[model samples]
Target: MSKPSRLWSIVDRRIHPPLLPLTTQDSQRLLDTIKNSFRAQLEKEHGLTDTIQATPSTTATNKVQSISNATTEPPRAFARPTDQHLHSILKNPLFSHQQQLKRQVVPASSVESDKMIFKQAVAKGLMNITRAHGFLLKVAGQKNTEPPVAKIENHGVGTLVLEWLRDSGQHRGLKWFSSSPEFGGLLIRFLLAEGHDELLLIWLDQLMTKEVSLGATGEWGITSMVFRELIKAKTLDPTLDDAYRTFLTGMNMLEGYSLSGKFFSTAWRELCWSTTVLAWKYPKVPAHLFEPFAASKLAKDPRDPRAHELPLAHLGLHHPEKPSVELALEWLRRHSFGYPAKMLLPAGSLEMARCLERLTSFGIDTAQHLLLSNQEEEAKGVMEYVKKITKILREKDHGLLPEAAP
Candidate 1:
């Protein structure tokens, strides 16, 4: 079918000009007009009559006649009904009996705390109170006061306190365009403490991108150092099935290593230098990246003065049930390269006992290889280093003198 032509071939249409951009003066005029219109509307709505014209005249140019009923307007914007105000209004003697007659049974672990406590703590700010109290006790000082009604006993309190702070401390929020910088720092520190290194990275990413004014190196100093040490401590696990598993996962995490360079400073360098280097390349290493450090630093220095520390050499003195022979041998290779020479020496009673156990399980060649690797002088040196760090419980149990336990 043909299109309809009966529609008078259409009348001529005119295109309106595009809306003109307002200049500053035009904008001021418009704003003034809007304000006056709003005020007139309010007056009309509130029964305050005025002789405003069809074309509204500027109040600055003319005075309109006011209505006989018009009076001074009362102030606007009274106090908002906040929780405290609501409590004052709703609470009377009525709720006190209800609130107290049945006390809220708070849980020992938030694992046990119900949805209502979580919501109330969130809404009423009591959760923040408990979190801040817990943080203040744990991080702020050694002498911590109990939460108003903390029910934790023994290590239960410390463990639960740490858990609560980790989950609740950085209840992410912003009062303005920027986040709470104070909360960010505390959140990062608490996450690192709880071994939540991944969470720390996420927090840093938010701070860096959202708030440029926050000093990157200022509040972040201790947090970065803590991440390095935490990974180092984890690697010392005697049952390391995959030596790099935890570290690699943590480093590859989103926003991970955001503050790594700042963390590698002089104060923490000696204590955590090797650890920091290992953590730096974690999941994305090119394989050869670790070669230099493994060859240079770890090989050169395997002993720490802190007697409680795990020594690579001690881990290398393998029993069948101990660390892998391959790992022990690799560590031993690095040890020899760094140490250069051994100081193996005469036997001590404790050494005799360990030697006997190793000999019984790992055979003579392994012992002799170990004994031969560190000649008497070097063996004695490493054994002494081990003694310096370990409690030597076997020595005490067997009543062996330190001299014979060498």
Candidate 2:
């Protein structure tokens, strides 16, 4: 028994000798003490259950601030934001990355040929340098719609000198000039065509730093081709650091939001299903990050899974178990220089033994597949990905083993 119970026993024996019985006053006092102890135990358990963990946006010690009025009148049953406040919450997170990230529909009636369009973009010095570096200063200087095209062709800049500089091993020129936003976009396209994500990250640091348009949404539009190049170079860790960077760029666009600035009515339930699938796919990747993203979108109204098919099945999956669309999203959130395949490791899962069992039959040509498909090896630091996790599993089992007699 517990100390309180033992103390109660001692007090009971002292106050009320079993056959002699207790005086009414002593009996009442003893009952009160025992009742108080039970109440204290109940309060202690409630406090333990109420302990909250810290999250990225919220600190643990933050006592929730209530904005209610100190009125004698009855308080409003619910709190609601003002209309303008709703707009910011509904649209502001994607305020910088909108239209540009979505592929614009090329108008059928537009007269410009594809060749002419590319050539004009090239001519305006748009392809040559960024609008920031005075490369487009002259084009931007003219108060005409056609000036950008003229600068490209008239400059006899058939080829940008930066390419030659890049090839010639002039490091300073490449860094200074390549960091230009206009050049960064072209270079990204060029790298995609050539299959070079790793090489592209050489310039990605600069690309990410370019002024994000405060214009209500932007896309981290670095295409798959460029991502492939990085996989070739072998750097993608699906760690928190990479995830933070992804958030800064327009890459991790929250897909559930709509243009009309409403959560798709069916979105909540579908996202929950998606999160559940991730959680169920244990011994693959943990549900730590995935869980919340899924949960946050799970319900504008919990009574529905509004969108049919979750609208993500069409996206590709890497491991047979992973939902491809979700992985693509997570990767955009900041794989950094890490590979895309890190999520495949056993240690990433909730269970270790399952990962080990599955690893036994892992494909040998996974890296080659990445090279072929333009993705890259798995999503983690390759060496430690396997070794460190194996050690963790080994230690777990060792701890569980029974000791022999000395």
Candidate 3:
């Protein structure tokens, strides 16, 4: 106890000091000392004798003000060239007055200006076409209304533009503009607004047949828009089946042209999904409508990885009501080791299971018909073919057979 008390007494005395309050005079003195020290430091560092400078005389101040005023004055505006200036520049001393007058009076050609104005007019007309179709109505917070057919007919803006292009021999411009999907789509809409279905089809045919290079691959050019619009029209009116069929025929016809055929094949592959959707909507449409596509060499070509997989798979899965699955089975039978058959048999196990079910049902139906006709041998073959396929598929995936088997 004595040793500990002695150590604590020494620590308290060394570490803790007595608190003391300062008077007003003491606080003022402390602040003056700090201010003097800071000012002295700043003056020493900046090489200044005094922290504040003396004010200038009234005359010096006035001189400075006048100098600032002179420097801050606004710049003068530019002036136009006078007739004298123009004459000095234009009247060469070597030429006579009559020759100079004749040269000045000769008119400048306005051809370039007219061409620029025509191009601007074409751009504006295209914009107006979109506006006529309610392109801007959404921007103005308004519901879209039908295109003003009466106004379009009265103005004849599109017609007049086309006529000018044709009459003025602007064939290149006309062809490029007509081939543009933007312009082509607007023109189609305009024609539809005017109830010119026959004209629309004719224009579409011309566009498809034109020699112009189809711009940029995968761009969904004029042909794609034609199919889109035709599909939309078919959806609204089922009787327009012939319209779609006619367009398909036209597209198929393009397969014969060398340059256009390449484009058509690409477009055909891309639009296979759309065709599947269309076929699904109208199952009554005959299977032959798509048979040409499914049976096309392009669909069966082994070189293209995307060739056989899409068209037949889409038909089998989506357009099952048609003879699409039959077409797929026939394709598989022919190309047993090809990519598509690989997809049907192994890679797409679940899909292959479904196809087998459909094949079995189809086989049963045929076998029943054969039995009714007293063709026992043919019926046995059909049944045996169905059994062989089922056995092969079951051996491929034993786990799926229990769930897939009826």
Candidate 4:
């Protein structure tokens, strides 16, 4: 105790006046003074006091209230127009023009909306038949995200147009349908389905003259459907030869303009089938439809001689009694020289041997033709194959052959 008291006395004596503890009120006053000094320095550095003093307090309060309200409230959603409103809008010329312009700029939204509007108009009976037909043509011509065929069929628009055509008469409708290839194909399919033969015939007649272009395969399919219908009709009533002839003329006209080999082959195959049927049913109907195919340049090409096989086989098997076989044989003889033995002979050895024997009976030497064509090895092979099959047949038909002369 003595040492602590002496040390404290010495420290207190070192200062001129000893320190005294302050009251709570004096400490509070000091803290207040320090806070005021700091606030003044900050206001001077940032110029915040002047800004706050210049701003109207009422406006500041209003801005705060507005921000709070914005945060608390939900945003309003866009309202889609009703079908009636869309119909009215579509009917308005100015609105329609704007939509057309929008379509040119941004096709996605405009096309879908236009398609919807068109469907709505048709459903509400707002658009007339002619107007609807024109609209469909315009839509078909555009490059749309949806396929034109799918758009027409899936949307029931094709059905609506079909109904109008049926009610208004197909004469005018055929013109409407023929305005576009898409429509033309749809019209043919509809006509065939409904058995509207008279109108279909008129459509086919018009198709020959019209420059409407269904793509190669599309055109082929349409022709096949029509031919099948005509064949069916002919099979049912053999008096429809005029119908068949009209189709043939139409096909011939198409063939003139078509450059597709597939087109030619498809046409020839169909004609062969149809001609075979006709030959069976009506002997008066000339069996020479294949003559045009045989005469065509396609038949003369040596590289793809197999193209001629189906038509020839059709004629040889179905109309064996007709002169078509003789015509086919003459064609073969002329072209056989260029053909490989595989192409020249039938697929099966037995069939080939019998075919050669038939050629021999016809006084046409196939081996000789091959040799003349510079296919000597192939010619020898044909002769050997024929001898083998003949020996086999003789062994099998021993009784058919005369007893050995003894």
Best by TM-score: 3
Q: What is the C-alpha RMSD of each candidate to the true structure, in Å?
A: 17.9, 31.4, 29.7, 28.3
Worst 10 residues of 4 by lDDT: 144-153
State in Å the error of residue 403, model 1: 29
The order of the candidates by TM-score, greatest first, is 3, 1, 4, 2
Cα-based lDDT at residue 14, candidate 3? 39
lDDT of 4 by residue, 1-406 (tens): 4465543453454423444354575455454544445555566765545422222456469678755774355553322223234554544432334334434322265445555565445445465545654555554554423232321223334544565555445545244443444445444433444455566656554544443454434444444444443434333334334534644554565567653343334444444444443344544444455344435544322336665563563345343234434444455455443332332332344645544444333222445545666878866765665465445444434443332321
| Residues 1-406 of candidate 1: C-alpha lDDT, one tens digit per residue | 7764422222111112343455676556556555556656665766657624333354433334322221333323322223244545433322233444245466575434433333344344456543544443444333443211221123233233334443554444322112333333333333434555555445434544443445454533433444443344334333222233433333343124343333322212322222332222323323333332232222332233222122333323332223223543444344443321122213454444543343233222234445765565644544543443233433443454333323
1 versus 4: better lDDT goes to: 4
Q: What's the TM-score of every candidate structure?
A: 0.31, 0.18, 0.35, 0.30
Candidate 4 accuracy as TM-score:
0.30
- In candidate 4, stretches whose alpha carbon ends up further than 4 angstroms from where it belongs are 1-198, 205-224, 255-267, 277-281, 287-305, 313-406
- What C-alpha lDDT do the candidate models reach, one value each? 0.37, 0.34, 0.46, 0.46
Provide the clashing-pair count of each candidate structure. Answer: 16, 33, 0, 0
Candidate 3 structure quality by residue, lDDT tens digits, 233-292: 333333334544654665554554433343344434434434453343343445556555
Better of 1 and 3 by lDDT: 3
Model 3: lDDT equals 0.46
